[model samples]
Target chain A: MLEVKGLMVFYENALAVNDLSLKVQAGQVVGVIGSNSAGKTTLMNTLSGLILDQRIKELRKGGERITIMGKVIHEGQDISDMPAYERVRLGIVLCRERHPVFPDSTVLENLAIAGHLRSKVEVAQTTELCFDLFPNLTRWRRRKAGFLSGGEQQMLAIGMALVVRPRLLLLDEPLLGLSPAMQEKVVEAIRSVREKTGVTIVIAEQFARPILPMLDFGYVIENGMLTLTGSGRDLMENPEVKSAYFGL
Target chain B: MAAQDTSKQVTRRRERLDRGIKVRSEDIYALNSWREALYLLAPRALPVVALVLLQLLAPEYWQRVLISTTVFALLAISWDLAASSGMVCLGQALFFGVGAYLAGIMNHYLGLPPGLTLPLATLGGGVICTVLLLPVLRLRGIYFAMFTLILPLMIERIIEATKVFGGTEGLSGLTPFSHPLWESFLTMTALWVALFGLRRIMASDYGLVLKGINDNDRAVMSAALNIYRYKAQALFLASATGAFAGAFMTHSYRFVGMPVFALDYSILPIASAAVGGLGTLAGPALGAFILVPLSEMLRGLGGLRIVIYAVLLVVFTVGLPEGVFHYLRRKYTQFERWTEVGK
Candidate 1:
């Protein structure tokens, strides 16, 4: 389980994630849906500790020494301000949505590249499990990641992240650019993963339409704020949610 | 009928490609344009090649031409380090001369043979270069190139003013290899071996990390790799290899001087890599062969080869900066990317 509290981030003076807090219980899938400029990516980047603020880079001439503080309790350990790799080692992984596989590498190489932080993922078992999960992958096992189709790439990315056997899986827009058939396939894969591993997942999506039924709890982040939070089914029928997304 | 014919044609094409067939497509033309990078080093080597061929035909110039080619190749290989890293270094001759002089000084003044003196001096030169790299490695773009250039220029002036290496003329006639032909062969072997080692390193994972840094610094760091260390390591390896070539040059030429460490020598390797193709294992050698011979032709015209050199460099850097090997590599990488993107 992962617990986030009073999480706030800034790009110099511009606040990106404004006083936001959220949590994912053990073995549960929590989805975050937001419109464009809703700070979904910023929140994810901040959480993963790859903060690149153009404002902070350019505007600040002198160090006012602005400090950021947040408490991230993961498996009952405080990991706020922890280095990114350390977070990776603690069974926390992020699948950067549409971009997961290193296109320069082979399909097998891309899949193997993940779980690098996990002290060990015996080459044989990892290959076996990954191949079994996506049968389409075996044919292009020697092919480069750059040669893969959208659905295949998505599968490769998800397969790569899941191989790490993380306690917390942060998937950012995993379904983006995927076809309808592949979308169902991805959902099926996520379900199977949840069934097998009980890994806590924080999947941020653009809309709540497709993923709402799968999540136990959900939040609708709007204009850099966590505007609404509720049980998944309740939020699905919420007027504001329907109006903003779901095209109701 | 069309479907059967098309499938058969496709199969035939595939078989031809497998049989080392040359496809005369636009891709090969692009590949050839990249191969034209041989102009970079031809300035250093072409004269030697021509001279050697002339000597072979005319009776006794083989030794001199062979000696000249090896020197140019060694110098070019030394400079290849900077060019391949996408960093312009102008102080390579400084390291090359330092290695040459160190080994020369010890051999001539202290009676050390090429065997003991050469490797030691090369290692010493590499150490000195690593120290220099510590400060200059922080710089990027022109500043980096300038600082690297400044080192050799400053050293050359100092050596001249201080009456070091016989004050500009330098120590001479101390054979690193006793015979001219032996020296040529040894030095040539050393250059190839050094290049072989370097090429292996350049094609490895860590080398790819350097390319990643050159491509996208933030992305590389985000992947949790050290950028500073990578830069330093690359420069260190380059310096060491340059020093090795320089040490071998001392024995072959039987001389070590400030002039040997001049801008001409410093920039030769860059030209070679540009012509041969940056990051290619054999690019510098190829470039050196092409360019060195042209230097002699320029000498006949009162050093007008520089104009040729400048023109070729501008044309290569402007029109074909990737060099032959890289251009070909990029084409394949692009073609593969296109295939993927299409799907």
Candidate 2:
């Protein structure tokens, strides 16, 4: 289980996530749905501790001053100030938005690189599970990740994250540029991932129609503020969600 | 998400905003107040005032150093200009040496005075350099930089082997300026003109295309603008400035030698640009002024001069990677204050 308390992120004077908070129960596929620039990526980055690295880098370059004021409590421990790599060791893995895989590396190598912290047996088991979950990736195991199509790359991005054996898996915009058919496939992959591994997953996405059906609990964010929070079916049936996200 | 026990948190962030005067002076309203006018004029006027003071007051040895500093400043400005247009020149000395040799040939062979030779070499060197590099204008980034790096060295070898224009001994007793004041005034004038002139050009629409070429040549090409032509023009402008420095230095020393193509000529300008800040014309000039004087001051250390210089360069680069000019400019324009978040 993970709990975010009064999380506030600011890039210079612009408030990204303003006093926003959310929680995820173990094995729950929680969704933080928001439109573009609604701080969805910021929330995801903060949750995975990637923002800490970004903050330090921007600070050193005197570019942007990122101020984060919040507590990220993971299973009763305060991981608010923990570095991203340290958080990764604690099984918090983030598959960043836009299908970021090692472009030059083979699909197999990309998965192996992600499993550096895991035991050989555990890695092999997870690798097998990833290939089983996304058969599209198994066909291009030896091919460079860069040469694969966008949908295939997204699948590989997910497979790479899964290889880490993450207890809390954060996928930021997993279905970003994928077509409708590809979106259905990815949605199905997420469904089977939960059924098989039972990992606590947090998916931040703008495409609500494909994702909403599967989320146990969903938070609808607008301009860094939580506008609505309800059960998946409750959200799907809501008029406002239907108008804004579903484009009904 | 009821009352969580997060009461112990103190949220504060440093906020940076432009100074009122900087914002005021950025527009036509700067003439409204003396304060804004002074703020606008001060940075621009400081160099002119300093140059006049140095001309009138500095010792003879320092005057020579000042001349050399200005020349190096000119070279740095040229380097910055080329770099801004996406040509990362590693052989600024190619432009320098070509101008030096041209001036030397004119003075030694044709018997032209310093006045004619300086102008001739400056413009001729720019044209020659542009033509020489026209073949490789298509190469971007490191490939272009590598070509430039190898050129001066290749030229140096060619001159040595061919034994042209005084060969390795070089042309001596060619021409000296009438007075040190004239030399100082000439170099300083050229330095400021290049700095301010290029800065003004870069702020124009013409400079936008040059910058676009650097940012994304493909995008600029899609806009139907000939990026190579703009790049060549930028190269000519940059090379002209460099050539002027080389030509001026030849007149000052009363000699033009193979050392004109030395790696120091190439490397020092880049080092100055890095220390001062790249992209900004004035930054490179400021950097050259700082570095050349610093190098002169460190002359007593002999073997350890370079060691201390390298250490200081490292410290400046590591401590303030944005460069001193940028850091100072930011401080001057912006004011920062710590404020409580969510208040």
Candidate 3:
């Protein structure tokens, strides 16, 4: 299970995310939605251990330092202070949207490298498991990732995250710029993998029109605050959510 | 309606913004493991094997060419290590030039034997470079490169001006080579050893991190790697190799001249690696094989010799940016794409 509690983040002097808290139970699909500058990216970056502050005089229970306050619990471990790669090593893998795959690498090479933190696994074993999850990736395994189209690159990215066998997979805008059909295909892949692997998932997405119906629970972020929280179906029908997100 | 669209846009923006900031990219995997060693070791043995064959077939008259080429090859390997590891350095001659002169001085003034002279010169160069490398930790890229070139040339010119060490005439009567064949043999052995050692280091986990620093330094640090230590270590290692090469040069011919340690000695090895390819282990060796002999064989052709070599180097740099071996690796990738990978 992954948990975030009393999360407060500031960019130098400006508070970006304030008093935010959320939990990702094992095998649950949770979503965090916000527009640009809503502190969602900041949260993800902070959680993933990228943005580090030198003035971090004190750390909250979950926040990386005093300039920040948050709780990020993963697999019964509090890795809020851990570096990003260590988070990856602990199976908290995030696959960013767009061209996440290494362009110079072959698809197989990309998948194998996705499991790079787990350097102990034999190459052949990694290939077999990765190929089993996304057979399409197997077909394109030897080709350089750069030539892969938008959708293929998305698959390769998610496949890379899966190769680590991440217990908690964070998908950030996996469907962006993708065609509607391609978006549905990627979401379907995510759902199938969730069911197949039973990995806890925290999906931070903008195009919730398609993803919300698939998620179990959702949070609505307006100006860095959680405005609404409920089952995905309730948030889908909420008049406030409809006004804020959907033109009904 | 605009507000609704805006909300969707905000959510979308949030999503794209979050990504794995971990620096362990596929290139890291490629560079870190023993596979990189295979890339270097397999190809480098080719030239060494070729040299061994040439040694059997060729006569002693070619000793000068063989020794100069081998020593230059070692220098090339060292230069490649420094250039490829991180940033750029044209100032490698700081140690190379210093070692040559120091070796000359030791061998001349102290009358050190060939056995003692060679060891002293090489070890002295290595130790001095290792020390100077300390003050040079902070420099990067062009700045780092300039730092190397400026100080060394100034020092060389100053020492040359002093004339206390034979001035413009250079130091002579310093006979360091025991036998003609010994010089060639010693050089070849050093080249092979340097090749083996560098290839090993490059293949190690350290090389992978160094590549990470080269490609994207911030990201590597975000991955929590120690960038400064890696740079310092790699630079020190490279200088040590140059020390050996310079020491060998000063002792082998029993002569020390400013012109000998000029940019050509430095450029010769770098150009060899460049023509062969940067980063790849065999690149420098192959470069040395092709250019050193060509330079020696065609020295009679006057300026055309350098012109031809320069043209070839340019063509290789432009046509094969990855170097000769890397080009072959890319071809291997392409071939696989058409064959098994396509299906």
Worst lDDT run of 10 residues, candidate 1 chain A, spans A58-67
TM-score of candidate 3 versus the correct structure, residues matched by position: 0.52
lDDT for model 2 comes to 0.91
- Residue A213 miss distance in model 3 (angstroms): 14
lDDT of 2 at A232: 85
Q: What share of the true interface contacts does each candidate keep?
A: 0.00, 0.19, 0.00
Residue range A50-77, candidate 3, lDDT tens digits = 5443323222111222245556777677
Candidate 2 local lDDT, B1-343, one digit each (tens): 2222335556678899899889889889999999999999998998899888987799988888888998999999999999999899999999999999999999999999999999999999999999999999999999999999999999999989999888899999987999878888888888888988899999999998888888898999999999899999999999999999989888888899889999999999999988888789888888998999999999999999999999999987788777778888889899999987642
Ranking by TM-score: 2, 3, 1
- Evaluate chain B of model 3: give its TM-score: 0.79
What lDDT tens digits, residue by residue, belong to model 2 across residues A1-248? 99998888899888898788788999999999899999999999999999999998887666788989878999999999999999999999999999999999999999999899988898899999999999988889999999999999999999989999899999999999999999999999989998998899999999999999999999988898888888888889989999998788
Error of 3 at B12 (Å): 36
- Each candidate's DockQ: 0.02, 0.36, 0.02
Write down the DockQ of candidate 1. 0.02
What global local distance difference test value does model 3 have? Answer: 0.71
Candidate 1: what's its TM-score on chain B?
0.73
Residue pairs that clash (backbone atoms under 3 angstroms), model 2? none
